[model samples]
Target: MNIFPKAQFLILLSEDLFSHPQETMNKVFQFLELAAYLSEEYLP
Candidate 1:
């Protein structure tokens, strides 16, 4: 959506995992939550 493919973004995350697990996991969940929210068309 931001000129970057989600697939590529995920690959980048995987590459950084060893260096930053806590931060990456937090962000990964955030992204997952956002995806779920968007799919549900959340309004809150």
Candidate 2:
């Protein structure tokens, strides 16, 4: 059996970031196993 786990990777599109900043940040938080803690007002 393999002892090491696979690494995780997340890809963010520039268009999506510009179009949907909040959602994009949510995806990032989810990827890192963190709660959706960022709000729209905090995004650029």
Evaluate model 2: give its lDDT. Answer: 0.79
Which ranges of candidate 2 are over 4 A from the true structure? 1-7, 42-44
lDDT per model vs. reference: 0.53, 0.79
Candidate 2 per-residue lDDT over residues 1-44, each given as its tens digit = 26655556687897887788888888999999998886647445
Worst 10 residues of 2 by lDDT: 1-10
Cα RMSD, model 1: 11.0
Query: Each model's TM-score?
Result: 0.43, 0.68
Q: Clash pairs of candidate 1?
A: none
- Give the best candidate by TM-score: 2
Cα-based lDDT at residue 32, candidate 1? 65
**Per-residue C-alpha lDDT of model 1 across residues 9-31, encoded as one tens digit per residue:** 55445556557655555567676
Question: lDDT score, residue 2, model 1?
Answer: 84
